[model samples]
Target chain A: MAKKLLTTLTLMASMTAGAAFAGGHIEGAIKARQGQMQLYAHYLGILGGMARGNADYDAAAAQAAADNLLAVASLNAGSLWPQGSDMDSAEGTRAKAAIWENFPDVGAKSMALTSAAANMATAAGTDLDALRAAMGDLGGTCGACHKAYRGR
Target chain B: MAKKLLTTLTLMASMTAGAAFAGGHIEGAIKARQGQMQLYAHYLGILGGMARGNADYDAAAAQAAADNLLAVASLNAGSLWPQGSDMDSAEGTRAKAAIWENFPDVGAKSMALTSAAANMATAAGTDLDALRAAMGDLGGTCGACHKAYRGR
Candidate 1:
């Protein structure tokens, strides 16, 4: 019964993502949003690499990457996240249904990322110690959202 | 003789990249800067995808990607483009020696990117036509820089 209910909800949500754009194609939506997520990962990986000493830290480079994160975070994301495009409805997506169920919270999380990125950008160009401190806060913010709202 | 002189200059420039962070590893420097460029590509690709109609346009998404490009472009880049780490020195870099030979021109090109990105951020979310026009300018600015300073 639980599986059946989930299947029905998934179909309904998929419709929401597809129908949001009217003439918009669902596959394109999925690809665009997923691509955005991949961009996030590419930059975050650079920042993390510096903090971990896995890659050398260049203050300018660090600053740029941090600023990029903040810029991405500040975007209005609603259009990219149509109601049904969660992992359930989309292929290659890991977003959970909770993103729609508690969108306000998701928004709060996005804001948190922005705040964290701002902090990181300020410190990233100063010194490694400062960057390391800011990195911790930024990572925590991202992890919190993923833990609460994203799917496995 | 020109080829040999060029090889000598390449080695000398590579040393500059290696020496920038006294204790830093050269391979790490290469990775870090290359990674930064990749992030730039990632964000720019999104903006371009919208402009090209290869992907669905979501105003919010376009704006975010444009903003991301602007932020990345605004960073101090000297550290990333350490004197020696051009295509000649770094294993995976495509940077041209001309970047070091005529750094002022490189700076000029960078400024062009900044200008174009600023315009893009302003128009990307509000008007597709405006975004399209700005996108052309932005792409042209990038091309100008690559043509002068990046290796084929």
Candidate 2:
């Protein structure tokens, strides 16, 4: 019984330590969120090229990129942004303090991107003109969020 | 006819330039793929903590992490592996030349990860025991690929 109790105590101690580590290590969260943004950029770049006629519009590739964009955009990424990990506190990140200050607004703005991405995904595989039309809405969401929440 | 032919020539030149840029400017590919790896690590960290009993097993969080892992693992990421972006050629990547040399093998290895992640996604939300069982397979796939294709 004593041994079992000791083991339980150790596990509890380790769990507490883990929680502390998770709370403090915002660097990992910062890097992970930035990586997620890179994915957004990559998929967006593909669709943007096709929209601008800089690259030929392949239906399959367009669909794939748009689908990927929607998948990442739809993620519940709240875990990636803990308090005190904004531009003022963290290095190597452009996420502004306004993100935490204006939480619901930031969330709503992100939802706009998700909605735009859903529309883009539906239209991208259809045709170039359809993709072109959807691109405007999608791009606008990205720009709005960056302008409001990302530090230059 | 003459003006149309000139327009065609201009488009062709731009297309060729775009292809050349895609083939040569491998820095973006390196960064993008590395970012992808970062995502895999992040999602895996979430599940790993629960599997190791370092974090309490929340069914929802586990499911979300597993689903995200499967999503990224299933991406058609061939474009991210442009030939010249290996460890020896790229500055900020640990992808080894073996990856290029053994393309089919690398592809097969990646498929294993996808397969494992799919199973993990199914099992993770079920229970802690199920998540623990799935984690071993998922972690093994990661280790196998890193052992063969990732550089030190």
Candidate 3:
């Protein structure tokens, strides 16, 4: 859990620095994707805090965050991942070339996130225990994709 | 409309540079709010394109973007606007201290965005004309808030 928090913090820090290193050509795309990721992290950060007892659980807040997560997950974001916008090609992104190479595999991974977010959207405001359970699935999906597609 | 697009392009550019101007203390709060604004822009950009015939109007795409806009607007974002996190106190943020001073006024302005977004969510997928009509309301709400609380 500590490691996960650390990773989240690290990701946020890098995201902040990313704007400074924007690639000249596809800078818009990079910023758009990074912004999406930041929103995901923002909502997840809220739920994670409640699940871990770092913050008191407010059902309305939890539900809103979960819904935001699902909405973002459902966005038609294909335009934000144009070819040649990977980390190797872009200055500030951590998207790996493997993502472009993976094609439908990356698409499937994104679907998993959507599915997990949908479940959490249902579970988040119900109760603390339910939120904790759902967070496991959501967090696992996030970690799985980062392991496969994200670069350091 | 050209002027609006230009303003949006300028906003995106500023948001991209925002991360580079971290306010040191409230950077996390600043980034979170900026991310929310970017998400709003992203969805609005999609709907605006379709409305203006800049992009072919797909019902599914329009609905998804509108839903995302509503979800983002509905976020419980009170925490992202801590006292002393406005433009006067934080770098990279256009949020004016007037927002903090306005109390429920700022809250009401935000609620206006939510209502407009909800209407857009219902209209966006119905037809181009419906989408265009709703966009006027949504865009007006955005402009009103920016004029009142956002700084250049």
Candidate 4:
């Protein structure tokens, strides 16, 4: 679809700043989780950008981005953010101690993301207004985790 | 599972170089596609590294990595790779003109990757030998694209 093509083009324009990762910061488990997060953010940004008119709206791209976000959200990160790989223990991540210290809350927050992402995936592929609303909910879910677990 | 934990630790040590992305250099469509590839490669590396004994084979990690790979590889890249966003137009990518010139072949190659990735997703979570075989087949599918469409 034309929307898909345009979305892909728009994403191409928006995703540039995310790829310049220094290639030496957090190498192991932390890196994997962070890399996954970067991947998630890029896709979400694409959908959210489109919804806000910050970028062009392409339905296909939005759906795909939402789907990608959903998949990452559902990934089994049980082994990724290991017990000791939080920012306090690692050098390159912003993940806080709360992710492990309160795994239940973190788990609940993660599920919220997955649920929001699912809504976005369906809404994104449908229409702009739906996409916008769904994206806000998903973004809120992300903020919930960052507010409690991500540190500056 | 212990091997998976150790592999994750070793991956942490070996993965430092991938995190050095500068954060400002590449910021558009090409970057999105490349980022997706980087994500794909990271997950594949986890599996391939395990298969080769270069890293410990943690069944859970391997399965999760494969699932992640399948998810990313199966993403709707429709907008991610736009017209004129090839390597010739982009600075940090290796996609060749043949991708557009031989669109059908490119489509086929992409589908091949999807098929292989699906197999990997199914095999990785089940057993080690299945993971190894599926990975080789998936690698071959990747090579098919590089052989026909990618540049050095």
Every candidate's DockQ is: 0.10, 0.23, 0.20, 0.12
Better of 2 and 3 by lDDT: 2
Superposed by TM-score, candidate 1 places the C-alpha of residue B26 at a distance from the truth, in angstroms, of 5.1
| TM-score of the B chain in each candidate versus the native B chain | 0.80, 0.84, 0.82, 0.78
lDDT of 3 at B125: 88
Top-lDDT candidate index:
2
Write the residue-wise lDDT of candidate 1 on A1-152 in tens digits: 23323433443354356432433344454555554455466457667778889777777667666766665555445445666567897777788888778655665666677778888878988988888898888888879988997788
**Model 3 lDDT per residue over B102-150, tens place:** 7556666677788899999999989999999999989999999999998
lDDT of predicted model 4: 0.65
* lDDT (Cα, tens digit) per residue for candidate 1, span B49-101: 67787767767667766776776566445444556566886677788877778
The CAPRI category of model 2 is acceptable
Docking class of 1: incorrect
Residue B4 shift from truth in candidate 4, angstroms: 32
lDDT of 3 by residue, A1-152 (tens): 23323433433343334432234425565776677787788778878878988767768667767887887776654545656678997788899989766655666667778889999999998999999999988998889889998988
lDDT value, residue A135 of candidate 3: 92
lDDT of candidate model 2 versus the reference:
0.74
- Complex DockQ, candidate 3: 0.20
Q: Ranking by DockQ, best first?
A: 2, 3, 4, 1
Backbone clashes per model, in order? 3, 0, 0, 25
